[model samples]
Target: MPAARSGSTRSRPIRRWCRSISRTTRSSRIVSTRPARCARPRIPISTRSSPTTRAGGCSCARTPIIARAARPPAITAASAPRRTRTRRRRPRMADQNLIENDEPLLVAKSLSKSFGRINACRDVSFSLHPGEVLAIVGESGSGKSTLLQLLSGQLAPSAGHVSYRMRDGVARDLASLGEAERRFLFRTDWGFVHQDPAQGLRMAVSAGANVGERLMAVGWNHYGRIRDTASDWLTRVEIDTARIDDAPRTYSGGMRQRLQIARNLVTEPRLVFMDEPTGGLDVSVQARLLDLLRSLVAELNLAVVIVTHDLAVARLLSHRVMVMKGGRVIETGLTDQVLDDPREPYTQLLVSSILPP
Candidate 1:
């Protein structure tokens, strides 16, 4: 009986232990199914993620949950607009001032330049309104280039004066502006595209730098913003953005010219001067460039003064045509009137010379 009692006592303790373990297992399963409460310190509701957390600790502490919530949304097309919209940035001056002021944007009065008894330009008078494109057409030595230089302040006119309307609705003579003001105007308000890209682009620098330099000159110091702006202009000129890091010297003739255009247009200049921009290019390249120029001019409402010997280019790009001969404007009128129905004999001969393609 004593042995049986001892065995029974031992069996009772084992059975008690087994019952306690079973109770613990069942309780744990119930607790898990009922959703374990978070043991982490309470944070702001905004910082909190979904309430569904694992047992023992909060996942927020292990992972950067707060940072993920605080992060900005991804940049999508709807959220971020294209850089081309930058053209509209000067609406206050371009739209309001242009409307309030009825005067022409640019005016030249009897502009003449003489180089040692040789007259380059004589009695050149014209006015350019906002968003107008004027084409100067003539043979090689028609003084178109000289006239352009005088209008752009690259040369001092021997006889006449050039006046430009400022954003403040005041007309000021080009000569009246100080050197610093002229430089600022050139950087901000004017763009010059040479026939030769080498004359316009810095051959040693990257294409992006060539474009960004103008922005820098105008106090753009943010590296990221400058890069984005340069990239946008390059794309507008149909240049592959992948080649932005390449130097201008590495680019082809057409690409160099396009890069030059992008460089000039990045600052969104009010006035652009082009000297045979499509000169010496392949026929296809010239056509493509002309189309691009036309679209950009129309889109930006830019005022352009372009010098070209190509009559086709003048017809395609200009609102007004100025015919030059012997350092004088032989004919001047609307592009269609001047080209389709020539009033001057010289212009008639010039038109007849172009065999239809």
Candidate 2:
């Protein structure tokens, strides 16, 4: 009975060891059951493990496996869509006619300026179109200068009104505009080139300053940009960029005139008024200036009202001519037609006075 009891004790220990091993195996299987989303194929659970992490289980088997999508191919310039450029066509004669018929830029009806009892300009009525040059040709005492002053709003008319088309396409009387508005127009929309360069430009300031002053008035406060633009305009007016620091007082008459032009044109004014622009210059200088003016006017498509006594100047620069005798325009017509065949006796006499070239 003692031997049988000892055998039973040894058999009991062996049964307990087998039961512990079965429990460990079942726990490992439960932990290793992975979700179906894992890309890794079904892997067997490992029995070996780090002592610090776990007793007998694989770390990777306990953690969930994550799947990621493959990257797409990169796009190249060669595979990109192409862009096309549309070319601009030049306007035909019909297009020009249509544009002329659209709207007038400036219109004056029976405009007259009286200095007390003396009437400087009498009942002058005319219409100026965009991209058109109109020359008022007469003797020194004729009403052309006064008429120009009236059209530009420099002098108030006593009898009639002058109307100008604003940038917003509305025609407004100059007298109706406030002082600030009129000054604004002079700064941004209109330019006046005085007969004397000293009158047009600020002679005390540097050439760059003179040119940049207009820009400053229009709200351009950047120093570098204003200087660059002034330099470009100086070059355009045939003035040396090196002379940008020089004052207009030190410049020659022609140079000063060119600088004045640059100052006026820097703002790209819609309309420019000129009073005997080439009156004081030599023949060669006058020719050069006229050529430059013609090119610029055509390029910018500007409207100009130039008052000059020289019929040759009118012939060269104007598309249309208005012949003024005393304080009245005796005849008005196309430049060539008026100069070649004058309807009025005074116009005929004035045309005959020009020396043959």
Best by TM-score: 2
Per residue, candidate 2 scores C-alpha lDDT tens digits across 144-258 of 8889899999899998999999988899999999999999999998999999999899988999999999999999999999999999999999999999999999999999999
Q: Rate the local accuracy (lDDT) of all candidates.
A: 0.82, 0.81
Runs off by more than 4 Å, candidate 1 = 1-101
Model 1 lDDT tens row, 78-187: 65776754454556765774674367989999999999999999998999988899999999998999998999999999998999988787899999999999999889
